[model samples]
Target: MLGPVRIAITFAMSLMTTLASAQEVGSQKTFPARDSLAALDDPSPDAADCLRGFAWQNAAFDVQLESDDATLRSVRFPSPLDTGNPINDRVTMKWYVAKDKDGNVLHRPAVLVAHESGSGMTVGRLVAKTLSLYGVHAFLIHLPHYGDRRDRSIKPENQDVVTTMRQAVVDVRRGRDAIAVLPDVDTSYIGLQGTSLGGFVAALAGSLDGGFDKVYITLAGGDFHSLLVNGTNEAAKMRQKLADAGYSGDKLKQLVQQVEPLRIAHRLTPEQTWMFTGSEDKVVPFANAMALAKAAKISAEHHVIVPANHYSAILYFPTIIDLIVRESLPADVIPAALKSDS
Candidate 1:
């Protein structure tokens, strides 16, 4: 029923809308490739200063612990990034304990779990529960601006990305110290495991010191600039925000280089490191995962490739958890529950 002129105008408006949508989705065309970020792997003068600023002279701290169940305890500590910001200056943990055949508590190997970005606290708890079933005590630490640590003044999305990462590194390292001092944990067999965002933070934290006997990183990779610029989902959102703030090209690279895990990845021994990545991951990109693996000197066998994409990588959690248990715990110490019936 519309006239020719009205029909033409309507079509033009639709065409413009389609073009705008395409532009938003294709904005990453100008971003750098994974190989171009090699400079991020090299050590810089600022690396030592960053490490020192986050280091704690002592592992001992005031811990308020409460029992949630026979096998789990809730713990709280003063945040390593404490700046008198009550909301951001405290850390919470869910500690899963190992037990003997008689239900008595036992001193056992421990792993510090770093959670993913969103809904990570729930995932962290699942990982802790699974690790406990394998006889390894697990400590899941909530990262800055996550779970109980969330603050209105510095929401995770609003804070400087590099600063949040640095704070995470400090927090994860301190978590290792906290677990090591626990009465029923074996200090000599401490390990680290992180999923996605947590995995990236764990990579940097593990590199800072040889505190952990093993490091298991899942669904995570390196080259911060490349991932932010070309990645999908949450990564895409981050890119748009940075671009709006006038951070692109070399300037954006410089900002992310401050917390690039590749810079200190060399400190991680290949023998003690393992990585799990999805082959179809667009959020993290396959090349980004390989970069982290190569920097850590991990062997091809140690690098696990899942058939699914980023979100679907959860399908392999059982297999991934089993692998981590086998690598992290002593042969004689693995619990019967984790043993294969075959």
Candidate 2:
């Protein structure tokens, strides 16, 4: 017979193991057949028109610079679309400027960093810092309802995902224009980098007129409907919320299809674009990542597959940072340390 303490410990260990196994199964579960996702490709004919309208409206806005700090600056500008929420109509961006050996500002390559959805600005800040270390000016922008733009009254469940995504694309594109007017930034060499949710936004924003010289996306994929339906973690939760709000079958597909990245992915320059995906990512499945890559016409050489999951992709941050520095900036602009890391 086992002692009472031993029995309790054994039970606890078994419970923990069971939960771990369940999580693993959930993450690795097979997604629905690709045939079911085909409808996403044939979105409403108005989808392209909507995207073009947003681009046109964004170009008409006058971007205003609020602060002018050399190391760090804050800029606020009006968003193209009005969300009916005053707090979300405006945008705030943080700029991290890189300096030269003599402490003089260098007019070098610049990149606009887009933050992940519901991830605030943590990942964007990390990417910005890494770019600055590599001798590039970094501008990190907060999407609607993220970071400093968050409004307490606006809950995720009440918002329209399609509208949010469309707004994000517009905001990201406008961010590039904002960077163009900044001091010590090379407008001709401006690039774009976005992670996860931000990556999805970048795909669409960068596709518009090839505004960005180089586009780098990590942990993002195509087929918006498939990703939300078959994905795990955050994607799963979003799917559930949409379902609760009466979005199902054709209804859900139609709404999400409007913002599909494939619609404009062809506009992106394949040679100037790079994508980083996780082989084991369950949140955005590997198939979805490949779909986006294929649509963008990204060559195998430009697509890097890391041995990580959606959340664990952070481990390869250093590698990605090195690659971005090497490919986006001029060879002489890269710092000695970053060159060594490559």
Candidate 3:
């Protein structure tokens, strides 16, 4: 019933709307905080109690703890990246504790949250604090050379990304075991979530530990080598440039394959995963996400926030907090409708 000109205008508007929506969803990673955990000179005493079962790996940090009915504490342990390199020094951890609605300590499950070195501790703290609000205990971990070892050195300018990734997985396993023994915490409900490099770490860790209850990953890819080979980010491109200049492809490929999420997918439960990604992410492409998803052998629900970019995607902290708090609640008590939505 509309004239040709009017119809044409309407179609144009629709196209523009769709394009705008896609653009928004493609670029959202806004979590902002640098060296959050590093900002603290001393770990909280309560946090130390949370690490009761953990064994000290070094004076800089410790691991292995059994959860108790009392107050929670913060604790740390050595990460695989602690190669004594001052440029990339860091201590991984299991910190934070979940509580009940009555303010009494609840034996809720614990989770380990990881972030890229560049992102610093802000992302990890945000996740931990938010999870605490949701009655879930979480450890804000230091990746490679961020917290605890911010002054550590960097050995390989072009580090073995895959080996580095596997090391992270190893640390996560140790952290998980240390936390699982806690008294008030539910070991069966253990889970993980991360941002950027940490997100990739979470996916890989989930693949490595089938006992992991659930996963909420953001800005991560399933395939390690694919991300390195086809990535458009400054880091990835830089790695490629280094390779073009002199690095060996065989070594790169070997390392990447060892940590590639695609290769580890068989270890995860498809029903317990959630992946969030930006369509406009320059560091991690949508294709890599898709590839990882396909390789996961699970149909994960993808939360698309239209018009969000990489840096801003994590900025929606309140939303993430809500999801974690709600999802981390006692699984049996969750309403069917809310469960379906999550």
Candidate 4:
């Protein structure tokens, strides 16, 4: 028969293992139907200042608003990435101004949302609507070579990866600057969110520049090309197919690095960011995401959706996503002014 001490030790070890697995599984799974925001680090003054400038320049002045719904009537300003690329031909951006119940502009926190190319913008639109319902203002942007501008004009070749990354950052900065100048927008309180490629871009933005109080990313990874190369043996083979399609490995790496979120994750503070990933996601696998979180040394919530696949992860966790946006990002700070001039 086992001694009492041995039995107790065995039980403890089993319990610990179970608990660790539970945490991992729980983190991978989505939150309940009632969504909420996760706690984030306090905003630095310098970061807030920078965010304000970004909002003032990008949100307030650059957009041509058509209706109260905040849809784009026309684009008065040019894209920083606009190099006559056919891809940029159909892209558009507009201001999202928050308001109080009385129709006055509410001095609330603002967000600049970056989305994966194309139908992903539709997801951004939903996020904007949800955020607005919660009193937070959000601006949805159409990324390069995606959405309406996805014509032959802005092919992958036309998009200079370095320039694309830099320009996208500038676009966010300008949006933050525009928000800062708006009488109704709270300059000090700012957050950012993105999905897939947008998540990668958001991570780069958060790491390169300070000012964003909170950042919530989904399906983010370390190195873009590396994620492609090492996700699986099958993926590695597929990458070769791309090479066969005429992509040079070195050139691809350079392009992917220009926007690698993991390469820049070290630049962020624990208080400012949180990353999430689906365990079964194949396009951007769970292991690659773990490598990113581990490299950054941040306690990310790695939720696994059990047997769920990549395309299903988004659909399966909308409620959790709503909670993530509400709770993951920092709360907007109240500004001195009570109302916006507009």
Candidate 5:
């Protein structure tokens, strides 16, 4: 027979383990669906001040769709960043097809969604489903060794943080072209979106050549090295992961610096790039967001501030998705005032 105090302690420990598993499983599985978005309002002109200016060539790759652990169809494509292993070189993306009121699929503007660091792709899937339901097609891309990209055949599919970041940028940039060529996709315009960890990668990717017509970044900010060193929650976990992998102190600083967005952010088309950040995000402090905004030279209206924290930003998705559609869709799709003026 156990005393009441011992029973209480045991219960508390069990609860803590359950919570930790829940937090970690996001990368392992997609959660069940959430409430649908309200009927979309007429496409309205938004505060975006930039225009797509370049015509860069999209990369070429072989692609195929196959069944996966998720609810939607899973697609695999050759990533531009290769590690010599055929299974390891391919990237994974979840296809969330858009449909009209009658349930018929629609060809529309597409957004390649980069997920947060959870590896569960919770935020990515949420945003993708919402966008698809709201009319646009969204692809939830898994960064290297994430989701279906993992293969048991390859003993350790994981790359170092720096290598992973570089590969993520390569995969994302190549994904724009890959998504464009898919059937039922309207190639007239394509958008790039990233949240948190994904946002940092997207920032540098869009900077490389401006291949994407529209860029949307959420819950991420600049000075990545400092963020990793001092940031709480996700950042802290990342630091621990790196330390466990033999990256500590100045070595960790050196690794994160290679992927810092500030170095290449100036290349982003400020007018066409929009940043959505949470005001109370402790993981990515407000000052860091401002640092990125400054580096990218993003216009005032393009930098949107949400009245929530990093974890709580999900609560504001209805409002955020509306803005994303207005910001990323083609001219005929939304006819924004900025597009009209240009």
Candidate 6:
């Protein structure tokens, strides 16, 4: 079943006019992306223990295209964070295929994107669209209870917070192997990008076993436990949700710890991981961002900071996309600008 667009984003890589919409050619070809989790092999007990919390088996899982089009393909896979519910057990990813001027799908780099906590995945979709414009196949994954996977019948108070978070991290990691088998992807380079809520999940997922070639975390940080206890806006809301569900004190700490970033962020290669943050951001805060940078061992060059707040960070969207394409992707894919964009 085709999932409707969760949010209609009306912006560009740099806050310019919106680009053309994806050509949704109803279901075309349904194929599978073979699991490439074997490459992430690590025998260390430390790595195993850390990833076991979220990655579950830390083994390969099925990734297949349930539906597709000329540009966008709907991917479905079994979530490693399975909770026995058929609806929430499956993972759905929006694959934005990149093509050349002749419209031939390019076998270029691919990036998996995780969205913020808002019901509408605004920034996540925009980032995926922007990255696709630059020749990288981008996949926007819907976390549990976000889009089609959401069980509208269940009330918010009844949802399981810890399990949802655990499943999210595992799903993101599985995305790396999922993209690895797509024909439109180069396979050699698969990365991840997450903003805010997604960023926190990506942080843990990217560290699971170095499955991704590159990882970018924007507007998120470590000590998610603290973020819940003291964060404002989305954090406060999520905290309240947990509180409503009778999760606090030791229970709350345990919930966040299951998917915390700092615990295993050190596993990611410093050169391949990047962190972007806002200087005056109060939602996630500068201190939180810095703490993640320190734990992840992100170099100064990799930890980019802009003088903006959480919401205003949208103003620098163009700059962020440009830098990601330049640094994370191969050099040859870089162009002065897309001919279509110009």
Per-candidate Cα RMSD to the true structure, in Å, reads 16.1, 14.0, 14.2, 15.2, 13.3, 5.6
Off by over 4 Å in 5: 1-60, 66-71, 152-158, 330-342
lDDT of 2: 0.74
Q: Summarize candidate 4's per-residue lDDT along 216-319 as a digit string, tens digits.
A: 66666676687777665435654665566566578777655545566556656665677767778777787777767765666734332334544565553344
Count of backbone clashes for each model? Answer: 0, 0, 55, 40, 4, 0
Name the best candidate (by TM-score): 6
Order the candidate numbers by lDDT, best to worst.
6, 2, 1, 5, 3, 4
Worst 10 residues of 6 by lDDT: 1-10
Per-residue lDDT of candidate 6, residues 1-342 (tens digit):
001111112234313422344444564444555444444334766546655666443454566674445667888888876687788888889987788778888878888999987776877878887777667788999998887588787764577777788888877877777767666678778888999989888888888767888888989898877878878887888889888878899988977776677777778799999888999888897888998899889999898899998888877666667666665556556654432232
**Local accuracy of candidate 2 as per-residue lDDT tens digits, 86-178:** 788788777767787777777888889987765545667777765774578888898988866778887866888888888888777777776
lDDT per residue for candidate 5 within 1-342, as digits (tens), equals 112233234333433432221111222322221211112122221101111211122444466655432225566677666667676578878877777767777878889999988856777777776677556888989887777776666543246676677778878877776676577788877888899988887887777666788898888888887887878998888778788888888887767766777766777899899999899989998889999999899988898898888998766555556667666565465423223323
How do these models rank on TM-score, best leading?
6, 2, 1, 5, 3, 4
Best by lDDT: 6
The 0-to-1 C-alpha lDDT of every candidate, in the order given, reads: 0.73, 0.74, 0.57, 0.53, 0.70, 0.75
Per-residue lDDT tens digits of candidate 3, residues 229-276? 667665476567558756547766664554566665555577777777
Worst 10 residues of 1 by lDDT: 29-38
Between candidates 1 and 2, the one scoring higher on TM-score is 2
TM-score of each candidate? 0.81, 0.82, 0.67, 0.64, 0.76, 0.86
Model 4 lDDT, full chain set: 0.53
Better of 5 and 6 by lDDT: 6
- As a TM-score, model 1 comes out at 0.81
Q: Which of the two, 4 or 5, has more TM-score?
A: 5
Off by over 4 Å in 2: 1-50, 58-60, 66-70, 340-342
- Candidate 6 yields a Cα-based lDDT of 0.75
- Model 6 RMSD in Å is 5.6
